[model samples]
Target: MSDADDAGHRRAGRPLETVLTRPRITAAALRLIGATGYESFTMSGLARSLGVAPSALYNHAASKQVVLQWLQDHVMTMVDVAGFGAEPWDTALRRWAWSYRDIFATHVPLISIMAVLPVTGAPQTLRMYETVAAGLASARVPTAQIVPSIVALESFIFGSAFDVAAPADIFETGALAESSPIFSAAVRQGEQIQGKARADVAFEFGLEALVDRIGRLRRP
Candidate 1:
């Protein structure tokens, strides 16, 4: 599915308040950035990708910086989409984490851009802020504890998916049949698990860890 497919919400036509908020524009920019990467990302390039003339986009955003700002907002919105699944507060967090990771994993090009980029005033950067606020307001978690707990868990799941998608080096390795039987068996079955199955395995593993992390967070 397209990135726009994942945008997941919309208002009919344009609203007078703003033709495009930072988040909406950013979501579009993300599709371009993810598809083309920073090196290829330019205002003209984005316009073409969106099937609009370059100037048309200008009505919504003025510059690449503006587009970038919107993209940051869009990233944060992924959290909102995560919330749509709506389980209990704690359960929702896992579903949220999995949704976040899955969304990013599906858009690897954007993830690559985000790796070194520091997210500033983008709408979504306030994710932890919002989550913690909601947690506190809802009395689901404590002021002293929520921040680090979310950060640690978020980083772990994101990092795990990245490892699966773009391993530091997939080329270097030999089977350890005796020392690591599971690893050896995986090596043998490796070809069978190639293609979408491998991706599903990676995705499911990440999802399980993400959802199960709730128990860990609540424990010590």
Candidate 2:
């Protein structure tokens, strides 16, 4: 074909549509947060990273809070809620708790935001809750107690995520060791324990206690 004819045909083709989408926005938001942290994250910054104007982002998400809610839901997808129906209640709870703590350990920055964020519009987050609630209900836990129980586990998991990110010598008393011998010695003893991480040990110990208490809530 002639170059002129080819150019005319190309001009007649459809204009390229904007590829912006919720998943793309969610991905870009996460990348932005990982690079600059939540403190610096902004709708304008997200648009910059995505190669679009801030108005384009607003087309999918109304506000930064809404974007964060979307991010929260996206992060929830990484957690292992499948065990709820497949495993025993206690076993499922343990699996879910470990997965939750581990996933959030790398995402400690999101914890404060997510802790207070409601699950109302976050479908994945709500789905996770539904699974846990169903498992607890199947174990015969009172309907009214289900939400509180889940909240208790989440409180522990969130705290544990922070603990996981803490330095190994987070308990180090150093120059003050002589002033607080017992606590210092306990810290040293904990350090001396082999194999598992201090965070894992503490999480397991606390999880067992919580599970024991929650298990007792079941009707005979």
Query: Which candidate wins on TM-score?
Result: 2
Give all candidate RMSDs, comma-separated: 7.8, 6.4
Tell me which residue pairs clash in candidate 2: none
lDDT of 1 by residue, 5-75 (tens): 33432344443323444544566677777676667789888767666667777876788866765664466
* lDDT over C-alpha atoms for residue 212 of model 1: 58
Estimate the TM-score of every prediction. 0.56, 0.85
lDDT of 2 by residue, 1-220 (tens): 3546545655878321145667778888998888888888999999889877888778778999888878888999999988887999899999999999998997887788788877787788888888899999999999988988999999999999999989988889999999999999998888787578888999999999999999988899
User: Which structure among the candidates has the greatest lDDT?
Assistant: 2
